[model samples]
Target: MSALTLAAPAPPASAPPPRQLRWLLRLHRPALYAWTGLVVVLGALLLWLGGPLTDASEAAWKQYNACGMAACTYDQDAILLYKDVARYTGSAVLALPFLVAAWAGASLIGRELETGTAQLAWTQGVTPTRWLVAKLALPAALVTAGTSLLALLHHLAWSAGRGRVDNTEPWYSIETLYAGGPVLVALALAGLAAGALLGLLLRRSLAALIGSALVTGVLWIGTFLTLPHLWPAVTRVSSLRDGPSGSGITVAEGLLTADGDRLAIPRYCGSSIDPACGSLFDRLDAVSFYRDYHPRSHSGPLLLVATGILLAVAVLLTVVAFRVLRHRTADRKGAAV
Candidate 1:
């Protein structure tokens, strides 16, 4: 019997190491450049005309701080800048960069699948995990940087305006735009997860974009409008001016207005007026008057809870997506041989 010589089977091809996939993330720079440019321009404009911004906030906050007949006063133009221009505009600015980040995140994997490029990458020794990580790394960094920059800008603008207040207006201080910490992180993560989910389900760049937009819109509306007030309390102060001590507070015989008008509420809770009302109007005399009004807001707690839920969902979905995409890629490669 002749000695049998058996040929060994060829080893399977391995994917490129994770590092090359990292190198691929450099493609996100172009979009970052454009967004940074816009932020710079907007910042310059706001700084130059912060006077008007401060004036506008003054007017609004003063109105919010007004007691029955005793209303606070401030420059209307400055109040406008702080309330209308700075706050809203800063939010809008922060939103733009995140929007771009969402589009990029959604496009990363989805575009490859849609265009058949992912298949090519797989064949070229790039594993699904490496490809996904590579694609996401740079964009995530850019988004974080962008958000930080926007937050800083908002802080400076708000702080400057805060200095002009006389400490009597309820809504005129800098603590109003307080949604920074984990809330922003949650929002960014939610956007990324939304993009990833779209990419996986749709497998088309345009479809992923649409999906991201829809998800983000729903999140914004749902968290801000519907969820916060779901549990309504007896007293709702929904404005910056509803703070503890920032309006005309008096301790006298009656609720005295600046014009010497007296006012009273039907029911007095204690020796002091309800903190929800003001401190100045707890007198024995009976009269009806709206205390200096500082409308309050409750957007913070609602946002914090929503942010936590979204972040958890994002993490779970991302893990599922990774497993599915990796499995699908491996299966396809096996069949192609």
Candidate 2:
């Protein structure tokens, strides 16, 4: 019977496929919950800002104003929520990355290291490289998705509000700055990268949190101060209108030109070329002066530089994290022997 059993073929041991370390990486619930709550709150706040709670007041919006001999008719209508709220809301949303950075950076990798749980995790089939990659992947995905959704919502809500009301509000004024596609994405990624680097560098939960806050604060101040200087060509001036002599002297009565080239007619009013040689008519070609003028005030170039710098920092810190993980794992293994 034993000989017969020995003659039977042994069962082949099956090799396991490579485990996806990503499955093990998960957001800490408290942090995830807080971030989700913040997102919901921001969305609700934006909706409230865009919605009309009350119509324009009859008292504040009079049908006509009695001022001297000039009877100014209040032909203007009620203000729309979009014009009043959109740009400001979008700008406020732009600031969300700071909060996201502070919260995310604080907890990112530091929490794992602090709890000693990551050490246990490394002993599994997962390599440190796979584990680190997994740690970064999920949070990066979440931040990207959140930022995209925010941008889309802003675009839809603001587009609906365009031209409905006077967009002269400070909120509306900043929309162009906040609404650029690349700027928004870069801001989000910058926050994430900053947070990840902080977490990796500190290796302590609270330290990571504080470090993120400090970095975010510094970035905000720096961006506010310097970004405008990086791309200045975007600012525009109104164009002057040329017309017949009947309306020729009307200064503010005319409309701005299509390309926004406000003329220096005031300076040319009494110049040598004027109809009256005594009346100087030096028509300064403002367009010619401004045409070749290239300004680098917009935030894009600075943002790119900042992004590259932060990305490099994040990579370096990540490398350090990998080394720390590997070294710790080797130490543990050597001790076990």
Candidate 3:
């Protein structure tokens, strides 16, 4: 009783720290909904493509093939539907990176910075460093998870149609291959990083949005130009009669000399089975036609190498984003502390 009387009232318990993540979720709720909706729609379409659509298209192809050079009756509607769905979905999947970059730059970082929301947060419980971390870490995880899911589903859907639907894209087809692999996931991550960095640098929403998308576009173009060269192309030599034999992505098809010199095909010269072509080949000392190509077996290596390059660029951009944030915050006179 005496101790209780003598003791000073304990200091009021400090208010519980604000949940930064709760605010983050609240702030980005619309984006979250939009992303969820997009994933759901795409996922549903992919499942349909892999199952019913594929089956229907395959059946139609069988009927058409069986009729052979005669007036044929088949489910032409199913085939056209399959093609349209596949084309649209594949295009959507491939376009995701640039779309993500645009949104990330315009809404995620640029708007926050441009509107003073980020600076306001820095004065509260959240430091500039912590704010940046919160902004990037969650979005990065979500983007990676979502993009990876789409890619896996796409690959499976594409695989289901292979050998079944004659019109299905080959494995090396750029849109099909990129949309249906881990490379898409890596590219998405890089786009996120690019958007964040560009938003921070420009500090203007529209400018950052355009800049990010352009950067991502450039990244993709570079990957396209660099992919085939990343892995060594196998040399498939066929006698000049067969006209350059390998089956997957063709890098180069040219005449090979007896001394092993690779020569470009002269104008109008193709298969040596052509009398004119054979005559020209014999005169040029061409002993065979050699095709430098990446077969189906090389798909794994090409995907892995391209993915690695994109990931490296993403990491570099992320580090720079953090550094830039720190420097900017440091100049704000302890506002971030």
Candidate 4:
């Protein structure tokens, strides 16, 4: 009897709870490395763009300006190089939002759900809400920090070239403005949210990737169309000889009648410098060419408004994703309990 009692097997040892955050990092280590590498490269390029490249371009522009009416050699290669670098780099910076959306949709959330890893983790001790929060919070922090840094550098680079490099984009140029301000950062955050929502909804990586891209593109285009109207534009009136004239984002431009009524400028009637156009302007009772537009000063207001809207959207999407996820898994959770 003593031997039989001693031979009884010891109770099975209990397993410890899962480490959600650690496991998450291990699963997405590849994406983490890739994102880090990309940020470093872009930061270095932006620094060069704002420093040596800007200086070289400015010098070339000065030389070109000094030539006057005479043919003289200038550093054309330097000018071209600056132009190419600024264009390509700005484009890349602006495209970052879409890239993030694709990755977040395909890899971050969708793949785990598709492969049943997400379910397995839930069964192992990680609650679904906690899991989703971990996924969104960590990536959102990384994306915001990286994108904000790049945007700051891009803005400094463009600012360095402003008024000095003749070929540089104006402050109001859509791509330049978008890349060099808070709008880029906001868009990226929105993209991350959009991708996450799509992933949970579709539960398929490929479909979610495509859907995220399309949704982000639509949001961007809508912003482009709506931006000019977000802030009040200044009105400037110039003589008919100068045509409708003003800089920055043009909201509306036409002719003003003597009674202060706004009228459309005639077709093929650009300038009063042209006798035919001058005659047309006179017959139309055009007092002056009027332009309602935003100057460089309005960029701040526009950006702030746009950024606020995007952030609100991101928050809304995040909340909805959590709700949708919970609703879908509610029955399963109840049964498990």
Candidate 5:
């Protein structure tokens, strides 16, 4: 007869449920580190610009202004230093979206799909929907936080130097317009969505990268062309003798003839205050000079409108990506069955 002794039942396995976020963080540790480093570097640069750099630049500007074209000379190094820092900071901020797009298309999705790793992940208890969600959600949260911080810092730095630095960029300048508000973060999110969609559609790392960059470039160009028209521009009309007043983002400036038609200034008149220019203007019946512009107050509305548009695009792209993934997964399953 066999012995009736039975071994003690083994304790139930105590492992925690699988976490897609942990796996995601583990897989992209290097990217996580790189993003952290970028945020820290940019934050430090903005701090310096707002503090010591601003003080030095403002002081130098004051000295130069006080000199008033006399014997006094300003410090060339100080002037150059501020200009270089401002330019570099603006360029860096502007370049962040393209970097996000490149990484999202090449490494985030395309490489995994290209290598069959994404399919392998699907077989490991991760649904396609969860996989895509994890991928986009993690990066989007990090990017939004980092970019918002940078934008805040940039606004601080720019405000610190305003009115004090003679060469400071205007509020409506391209760099300032994008980096000083929420629009930059919105654009970055849009880039991420576009990259993910391209990666899913292309499934090739190099092609996805190029496609992502092109998409971002097109968005940037479109924004640049359309930004001025986002809000209703203020129009001012003055006699041709007086000219327009109060500087802003000029949409159009032309001569308003007595016949109520707008005509561009003649090329021959070229900033000359001569009698011939006056005669030409009179002959053309140019009674008033009209200027259409976006005032500084309009910046907030324009930015809000632009941000809303970009965010809507991003949401639409993400939805499309999800549908595409679902369709592809269903097709594969059907083929296998």
Candidate 6:
């Protein structure tokens, strides 16, 4: 009699662990969709600005320039229209950092920690460090990519209108400088870091949101104030009668006297040619009208310096966030024991 020993079915194999990135994507699907939609819409707007809007604006500008103020009637409306479009587009690009900060604070880390999901995640085979890395890295990569693309598009659009559109902003204008270069990417990343750090420190979604916004605003303002000083300014000395020349970012312009004193031009000296101004200039022995400016060539160096500073700050914030998290984790383990 053969002993019928039924072979036990092989134990079911455990499913492979879900990837960190996949889990992050699944958790923040709404953010992903929102970001995708924003990029698409902005991209379309930039294309239009570079293409049809640019053409229309240029045509209108030509017509206006050709017609004397006395003869201007046909395309006056187009000038205003172009200005409106440019302003709106610039505003949208400039607002990206604020949006990134808000999302990072309210949704990315704050909400997760606030609701205890971050702790839950750690229990599911994810370490706190890995969780924070996933949170920061994914958003940072997306922000850098999106902002970089938009900046390139913006630069193209702005370049297309440079010589043709009379009303277009100069290259060194603050909005143009920030929104149409890699600086925007740096700002976005900085905002993300600031938000994350605040979220971790505050541990409450609303508080994190407000604190992050304030910190981001301060960073932006500080950058704006410090930018002109990032690179050496070019000094031009021209005849007091002729005022300074060369189109660049003027840092300070005043009278350079023969005695080497830098003094503001007198109010009475409205024009260099004014008799009263000429008298004052002669009396003061003003040698020349001096202008300190950041030449167009300095643009690259300034941008690089500012971007490096912002990145350094972001890295600092990230390191502090990790330290805070590790401390909190250790405290919890100590209590449990």
Off by over 4 Å in 3: 1-16, 334-337
Q: Give one digit per residue, the lDDT tens place, for model 1 in 64-154.
A: 5674466555455554444556555556654752575357545566786888877676666676776777666676666667655655555
**What ranges in model 6 sit over 4 Å off?**
1-16, 19-21, 268-270
Across 1-337, the per-residue lDDT of candidate 5 in tens digits comes to 2344655554332321367447865788799899989999999999998899889988888888898769787786887898899889988998889989988998898988999989887776677887888789889999999999999999999999889888888998877889879989988998999899999999999999999888988888888888889899999987666666547788888888888999997875633266787888888888877889998899999999989998998899899999999999999999999
Tell me model 4's lDDT, rounded to 2 decimals.
Answer: 0.89
For model 5, name the residue pairs that clash. Answer: none
Clashing pairs in 6: none
Clashes of 6: 0
lDDT of each residue in 127-236, candidate 3, tens digit only? 77767777888788888989999999999999999999989988999767899999999999999999999999999999999999999999999999889899999998
Model 3 misses residue 116 by how many Å? 0.7
**What overall lDDT, based on C-alpha atoms, would model 1 receive against the true structure?**
0.56
Full-model lDDT for every candidate: 0.56, 0.53, 0.89, 0.89, 0.86, 0.85
lDDT of 6 by residue, 1-337 (tens): 2345666554322321457446865899899899979988998898888788888888988777788866665576777777887788888998999889988887898988999988887766677887888788878999999999999998898899899889989998876888998789998899999899888988888988888888899989999999999999988888867767657788888888778899888876744687878888888888788889987799999999999999999899889989999899889989999
**Model 2, position 272: C-alpha lDDT score:** 31
Q: Please give the range of 10 consecutive residues that has the lowest summed lDDT in model 4.
A: 10-19
